[model samples]
Target: MTALVLSLAAVGVILAFLGWIFPAGSVREIVVGSVMVACLFANAILLLAGDGVVGWREAWWNVLLLVSAVLAVAGGGPLTTSVLALVDRGNTRAQSTQKAGEVLRGGALIGCLERAAIFASVVAGWPEGLAIVLAIKGLARYPELRSPDQPASVTPQAVAERFIIGTFTSVLWSVACAGLLLSR
Candidate 1:
């Protein structure tokens, strides 16, 4: 069960990466999303199958969680990529690189956000809550990441800043996870 918890998180990260890296027409979204949802749903089911969690015993909640999984896997990227993707309009390399950065940032945000959401939903026996939080973004957002000093840009660190936030977010997730585990 504990291993499932960790893998579910890994699934989330993978979805975040693919959502940002792959173009809209690509099958990455469907495949990654489906796998992520399935991993989470299975975890939820296993967590509830016995006398472990109380409200989790309900069958209807299980159905709801499964359906929610479908929805979660459907969405993509961060706020930026989504907006830009809608605006940029293609499968260009510029778009891919930009969106990749956005995905990294967004994945970091969800690292903490999804865990908090999942922890809350677990107590409520509403496993789908995690999926809802995960779907906050749709399609890739960033799509034209400039290197910050390419003849008309600024500093290299400027570009690194976007990725920096993502690293922080991942660290935060790790610390929080460690806290949860240590307390147990």
Candidate 2:
């Protein structure tokens, strides 16, 4: 399960890089959405299969993942954002075209954060990390967020920073896991 989660993350990361660098929102969203779905299934099957890993701790994280997956689909969160952005760039106004980049960049950041957080929560048994990831998704949806002075560079690294920061959530999650393991 962990391996699958890691694999999905790795693939998503690569896709995000490709998509962002090429300024191609179409390919980026497709890959990101696929990653989330794959992780959701892998996580669920891994838990349900009962390979001696299922427990109360895991149950909570699974529930969170379920909720996340549902939200992801219903709201078209990352998937729609990436696709729409790309489409807009191809056939839309200048502002909309630029906005697409913001959305994609933000979506990429959120996608990375979400996966990293979920993986961390699963391994570390910490739901806060997951919650944090949830909050980040909203911020990644815009162009000016922090101080409202962010430029419109639309570079991959600029967007990837959000993912990198999100990846740190996993480290914090590991700390939580260490604490839990020690307690046990």
Candidate 3:
């Protein structure tokens, strides 16, 4: 039963990511929202009725954690970007398009790794290390962020706002997942 539940959760994560990536109007939103609710509901059920998974060797629960972490890492970019885009709805198309390079320049891949690291590190009882991770990521992006050569069309303030919103969403999601896992 636990195995079956965890398997379903894994599938849910995949569907969620697919929905986010291939959003086709309201259908995509409905699918993603439904999956999100279902995942949370299923997780709640597992926590309430399933056997406790107190150790790494607990097969079903370990799989659940693995799936959750994958979702955090993989779905995080799309989720964060979507949220940020909505928040910055006032941004002109040109301004948003101008910042596209920031996203494409390894940001997607880096975000995945960052979420994974945050989830894994916190689960491993080293949550403090997340500060270092944030520092490194900030330092790595600082050069491009404030570069004098940055196109005049892209304001540093806009870029900074985007970065803050995106990073906060990513980190917060990872931390929330890790916290949930820890509770389990």
- Best model number under TM-score: 3
lDDT of 1: 0.41
Candidate closer to the true structure by TM-score (higher is better), 1 or 3: 3
lDDT score, residue 123, model 3?
88
Q: Candidate 3 residues 1-184, lDDT tens each?
A: 5665567567767765775666423446445645654675576566556554554356766777878787777667656665655665677744663264453367667888999999888988997879988999999988767777766666666677767776898898777566546755
TM-score of each: 0.32, 0.35, 0.78
lDDT preference between candidates 1 and 2, better one: 2
What lDDT score belongs to each candidate, Candidate 1 first? 0.41, 0.43, 0.68
The residue pairs that clash in candidate 2, if any, are none
Q: Give the local distance difference test score of model 3.
A: 0.68
**How well is each residue in 45-119 modelled by candidate 2, as lDDT tens digits?**
544454423334666445444443333322233443454454444443433533424534444444544654555
Q: After the best TM-score superposition of candidate 3, give how far the Cα of residue 28 lies from its true spot, in angstroms.
A: 3.2
Better of 1 and 2 by TM-score: 2
Clashes of 1: 10
Worst 10 residues of 3 by lDDT: 24-33
Which numbered prediction scores highest in lDDT against the true structure?
A: 3
